[model samples]
Target: MMAGSGRDESGAGGVDDAVRELLLLMPRMVGRVKRIPVPEALQSQSLAPRHLSLLSCLLFDGPMSVNELAARLEVAPTTVSLMVADLSAKGILDRRADPADRRRRIVAIVPERHDAIAAWLAPGAAAWRRVLTPLAPAQRRLFVDTLRAYEAAVAEERREE
Candidate 1:
């Protein structure tokens, strides 16, 4: 494939074309996501980009202990604990003793705030569903793996510099 032109040996657009398209599309995608305003119920709460994944995990996967959240988030349990504490204090999240294991605390979005949180995050999730729904399972895996590989490569390059 021509590096900049994105044309393959058969003159069919190939890998280069995909890369070029992604490069252009990613920023616009991010901008559109960033412009998804926080719902009125959540506007006064102290939230940030870091909370998105944590909340997304709970929203999509249901409640779990801080350690479970840390593992899913790829962060230290202490970090998740701090975020849980902060969100709980803000009344955006709730912490309750896990029924199955009282020693463990399960973290979740406060029941009353669930709708607002879901409403705030639903658009992006819906957009992803629309794009990925037509793909076969393996194709979806490939797409997700490709993005992860790209992210790893970028991080590796940054670290070397």
Candidate 2:
């Protein structure tokens, strides 16, 4: 029954609490940082955070329909549709009639703009690296492993649901 009790009690409670607190606060802290005013050059033609998130999803998951994107973003279809339309017009995304279903449109990142998207994401990427850089090699490995385990658990829960 309690197969993990010994391991869980071996100073793991403190580690679990620390991890939980970091998980709870990191998002809020990063969101606050993201909301701070951007430099003039960056602000002149910056994408909103929501748009960045949508782009990131498309970049990672490949092509997706408006409905699928809405589900992934947990937003209204109309909202994703509008965002897709904007990105399409900006040439960052390509929208075409889905081959499997002409009634639906599929959106994907434009190959030509991948570099631009990566450049746009550079600051956030660097910030994340900086945050992890202070950790020792072993701690870094443990942190990454823990995050992967957490992600796997979440995926399994979603599948069961």
For model 2, the local distance difference test gives: 0.78
lDDT of 1 at 69: 98
Clash list (residue pairs), candidate 1: none
Give per-candidate clash totals.
Answer: 0, 0
Runs of candidate 2 with Cα error greater than 4 angstroms are 1-44, 122-161
Model 2 deviation from native, Cα RMSD in Å: 7.6
How many collisions between residues are there in candidate 2? 0
lDDT tens digits, residues 1-161, model 2?
13433535335556556666778998998786686555443454446888887987877678999999999887899999899888787677899999998998899988877766666666776887998999999999998898878878879989999
TM-score of each: 0.89, 0.53
Per-model RMSD to reference: 2.7, 7.6
lDDT digits (tens) for residues 53-143 of candidate 1? 9999999999998999999998999999999999999998999999988998899888999999999999999999999999999999999
